[model samples]
Target chain A: MEFNAIYVIVAREFKKFIRERSRLFSAIARPLLWLFIVGAGLSRLVPSDTGVSYTQFIFPGILGMTILFSSIFSSISIIWDKEFGFMKEILVAPVSRLSIVVGKALSGTIVSTIQAAIILALFPILGFNLSIVQIIAVILICAFTSFSISAFGIVLATFYESYESFSVIMNFIVMPMFFLSGAMYPVKLLPEILQICAKINPLTYGIDAMKHVIFKFETGPMSPDIPLIIDAAVIILTSIIFVLIAGKAFERKG
Target chain B: MSIIKVENLVKRFSDITAVNDVSFEVEEGTIFGFLGPNGAGKTTTINILCTLLAPTSGKAFIAGHDCIKESAEVRKAIGIVFQDTTLDKDLTARENLIFHAYLYNVAKDKMQQRVDDVLRFVDLYSRKDDLVKKFSGGMKRRLEVARGMIHWPRVLFLDEPTLGLDPQSRTNLWEFIAELPEKNKVTIFMTTHYMEEAEVCDRIAIIDNGKIIAMGTPEELKKAVGGDVIYIKTTDNASAKNEIERLFKFNVSEKENEIYMTCGMGDTCIPEIINTIGEKVISVRLQRPTLNDVFLKLTGKTIREETSSGNDIKDFVRAYRKRH
Candidate 1:
């Protein structure tokens, strides 16, 4: 529970993030491609009954995807640290193991949030009008989503020994999570089994909560199948569970 | 008071015992060395003492704190320079030290001054702003040493501190390590395979195959090899060894064509030994015993022979050739 130790870890990660200019570029590029190319192209092929444009409808999903990818990849640095021997220094320090886990999780959250914020700044170009309340809601939801996803990443990073194995496993899990979360399409239109899978996904709650706020602001307040309160509850509960699991995994001998 | 105590400490990895029934004591403010060949459990013992790896049985204490039960206190009281480089390559030297200071909970106001002091101590203050990735191997090792001392722990554990450095860099690093006890009042527990490096230690424990074979001061261990070693090369080696053993009443071992034995004042005995078996003696050599000779006498093999399968000697040879 030493806040200084946590702060120092977070500060070092941020310093590394800032220095790696290429990583920052890729973080923004991936979401923009989905928004401009994928959203625009798919919208022309399949028209939506909702009055909002396809670009507007998928904006929140794109933001969620950016946060998901960035936060998860951020935790891969743990494996790199282990390979390079820096992790041993951290493991032997007087700080509690929980602080190291929390510090890494928090840094990933901040990095993903920053990446999401960059996408949020482009709202004007996308021709979306938002009130002060909706803007605050979007930022808050992004933070919560980023924190949850980053914790999940830490849990995986702890168990994985090498980047090759981690990358393979992440691709296996990440693609399914992203596709089934209804980021590209609405869950209501999916088959029964697909809908059930989407319902169980923690990310489904995040995107649903964001869509609720964004769509409500664009149109009148629409009652989604999953209420905002339920989405918020699931996101918070999942985050706590992930943080605890990651802390336990990190306590194991490296 | 002993700064470190290990009693019957054991560590096993599934079927193999990496450290077995090890026992030793390191007095405060002295450099205690573990000299052995590779895979001889030297690093394992150091890891157990540092709290990075727990012993399977038995016990260890650092600064009177149990390494297992009181790991937090033990961790706070000791610093470690791992065999491999542990500094963050992307960060500058100052940033790396600052991060270490924070992790050890150095006071916020004193952090900058402490970082500066350690950087200066390692003589890397001039390049503090450069990224560690740009540093030479010796520079990186020096920085790791400085980083380990940033918090000023009561004990320092250096695992193969100069494993891959050139002779000059190794000597330079030893100079810095030798001064740490007097300058910083830190007790050092180090493990090295190099016989020459072990000479700097106040006392050394020679380990092989996960057991301590001998423990004492350098001079004492060397003396344990007997007064002197005599190597006699003869046309008929077996006859010469038998002749010497019968005349001098000494035990002799032969390898290849040379008959080797230890005798009191080998310089004085060589002439008598040659004269007693005058026609048999082709050449004779008399020499004082070294730590290598001590290890050979105890283990029946030189330290380098034990490590022929490992890369330490190969890397040493490569580094030596590169320098030449």
Candidate 2:
């Protein structure tokens, strides 16, 4: 992996992401809508005995949603590159295919991290207070989640030839991954099958880790369903697996 | 020494054999053309040579590196302008070139100088700052060519570089392409179905139905199809052909009210032919054989006739939509 080759690809992708103003606007706006409108509306219905506001409960989930949507959509540029013939240029370069994958994955991770940071700015508004340590932990978790999901997007992008097919497949997978990850509600309260599905979702660990950080600060004693160590381990392992998958898929382009 | 060499290369896509047992060599510092109609495996052969598509059997090498086993080395030694425009529409021409330079590992300090030189070579330096989407088709094609050359590779592969351009732009592009060998010391391997375009090449291989039917310099291939071609439109064409055949001991073919004959020297034979076969000649045309005629004589059909079918039209439209 030539560092220069990787840097060149990363720079091009970042430039495109920054230039598209509408995309930036939407990346921030989509999750905020879900966080405020949906979270606020649902807060009224829940009983007060849970000891956490609905906004604070769903805040990590919204952060996961922001990272998920932004990172996955960043990979759509690969489909666009294929259609426009720019992919041939990249594939034929002297650099290894791994560099291209790294470049793309890192750029997507950056975009999603930035989007999540924007949502994080509303922490005071949601009436949640946290230490500097918790903020750093949340950022690191979001980065790992963004990297894994973006790698998954690249794997899907490699198989799809058009934007229409990619979007269709994304909708089918993304919604289920977010909904079943216990982003909206507690996994302990869900039915047995749904809880099992949540355990399988990699995003579940990401959100769980974040929730642990926030609730640990608020409630003083930590009692996460999954240990923080296990959550971090799963997210890191999933990212490595996805990066390998994406690299292999890229090498097999026909 | 040969800059490119292929031995019995074959590429198959499911039921279709895109390139079938094709073998050829391109010498260093020369322009080699692959002339074929659409779907005739021209692009497939180029792709295999450029290491974009792996051959199903046999092998190819670029600058002495096997395209498959040593693809990285081969890629380092060669450049490619694909059949379609590959420039990033969102980036300016200079940005596109700069991106390629870094990808190829051109030295950081030399990058600006190299980009400027190639841009000026293609006469695109003035428009370097404008986004590629604002460029004309000719400008975009020129920028693609410049981008391909940004790394300063030893060889350049252009797959149908002028496939869809106006006459003026096509001619201007060819002028720029023709100069690359002498000016930049880069060997060119290009593919085109157009006969006139192949004439500019130092040597050409005419491919049909996934096979190389003829290979030679343009003049040598034309001569192999015999000398000048004479087309005669006359009253009583059958008798006229027979009379000319008997008088000149030449093989004449007739197709729909016209008599076609290949002679050693058409102009020298024309007067004797007319005088001997008196009064029946309405008109006579004597012309040198073109690559199209060479293709026709070798494959029994013109390139256009082979691809002018209804299905080909649909494929053409589909390809057009894909490119635009």
Candidate 3:
């Protein structure tokens, strides 16, 4: 809650993230591959129902992928801390477990948002244009999405035993969520059950929102930006839930 | 005055009773050694004292602040250098110190000075700008101590402070820690598995199997053994143990290679016993018992010489994780 505590946590997380150049590299690469290579190649392969360019149709999903991956991958740092006994140091400090959650959430969400920013920077170059305010809203959308997913990752980190096991779990959890969240194709592309599954996915709203921003997909059937607002709400709520859970977990650890 | 007080402190993890009914007071300006073997709950006790783990029941207070009720104050009052290293290897010594200062909310103006002061105190000021990843084993351990001091804590908790150090480094750290009381009346509570190491503490509680076996100053504990010690080098220790048990009534404890007996007047008892058991004797020796001897008397087991070896896979990975 205090300024100095927050600064220490943020600065430490920042230092850790930057010092591990691999985290920086992988953070950008995962989304780029999904958006450019996977999204672009699959664009021509899938029949275009929306009648939009393949890359354009999936831009939302790709951006959502950006948020999901960044948040999940940042958890590696947590595992690293546990392995290195840094968690013990942080645990023993004068700061509250709640502040720790806040600090990790803030730094992780911001860093993940920056990864999305890298993708956003490439968006215009890829010929997807947005007005300046849309750009600001997009960053906020990514931030919230990242916040929710990263909070989930942080909670998982407490339970994670080792880096290798953490990687396996992350793959199982994150990859499915990425594909199932209607990021690749519209939810309509799936079976009825999958569509139902998509309805529960928080990324669906986030992706749908990004899609509206990038592709202007809200025409007659869907409100211009209803999904975005809904996704944003779910993300904020989930982030709050995960932070509280993580806070309680850390409190017990102390 | 006692700077630390614990009353019936108990800690449990599911069915495992890690520490039970452990209570002690550490006097101000005194280094209280908490001595125990591996799995002896030494770390758990220190964890409770340092506010890192709450007792499942009972209470512990640091510098008069309750660990449960006033954890924030307790955390502020004490510094802990855990058995495992906890420094950020990616950062320089100065950066690491400053970051810890920020957590303690040291003023920005004072933070740099404190960082400088601690680094110098640890004899690490010259290498303050070097990355910790580049540091050797001793350097990393020293930095952990320096980091704990950055906030100028009123008490310091060191869990197995020299568990994995070479003899030279261990000696250096002991001297460094022993001087803290003179520098300031900072109450020092350190856990150590090494029996010889605990002798330097003003007082020690010998803990084993999640309980305190004995508690006293080194001299008091040594006095607990009474007169000279009789160490019997027995090829048949079991028979030797039973034979010695029937022979002396004062106190007797045996291990693999030796049978030890303590009596009221060893000068009179020892020679007669040596004469009585002459034919079966390997050798007889009468000497002063060290803390190790006292621990052997209390525990009825040899003081284990298990060094913190990195040869084991688990230890290597754990140590590697601490650094990398």
Q: How would you encode candidate 1's per-residue C-alpha lDDT over A93-112 as one tens digit per residue?
A: 98888888889888988888
The per-prediction i-RMS, to one decimal, reads: 0.7, 0.9, 1.3
**lDDT, residue B141, candidate 3:** 84
Q: What is the TM-score of chain B alone in each candidate?
A: 0.85, 0.88, 0.79
Report the candidate with higher lDDT, 2 versus 3: 2
Alpha-carbon shift of residue B230 in model 2 (angstroms): 2.5
Of 1 and 2, which scores higher on lDDT?
1
* lDDT of each candidate versus the true structure: 0.87, 0.86, 0.78
> In model 3, which runs have C-alpha deviations exceeding 4 angstroms?
A47-51, A220-226, B229-286, B305-324
Model 3, C-alpha of A221: deviation from truth (Å): 9.9
Candidate that would win on TM-score:
2
Predicted structure with the largest DockQ when compared to the true one: 1
| DockQ per candidate | 0.83, 0.76, 0.58
How much does candidate 2 score in TM-score?
0.92
Better of 1 and 3 by TM-score: 1
Residue-wise C-alpha lDDT for candidate 2, range A1-254, written one tens digit per residue: 88998898888988887888898998898888998899889989865454777777889999999988888888768998998889999999988878888888888899899889889888989888888988988999999999988888888889888777865866798888899876888777789999999999888898888988877443321225677889999999988998898999999973
Candidate with the larger DockQ of 1 and 3: 1
**Model 1 docking grade:** high
Order of quality (TM-score): 2, 1, 3
Candidate 2 regions exceeding 4 Å error are A217-224, B232-247, B251-260, B271-283, B307-324
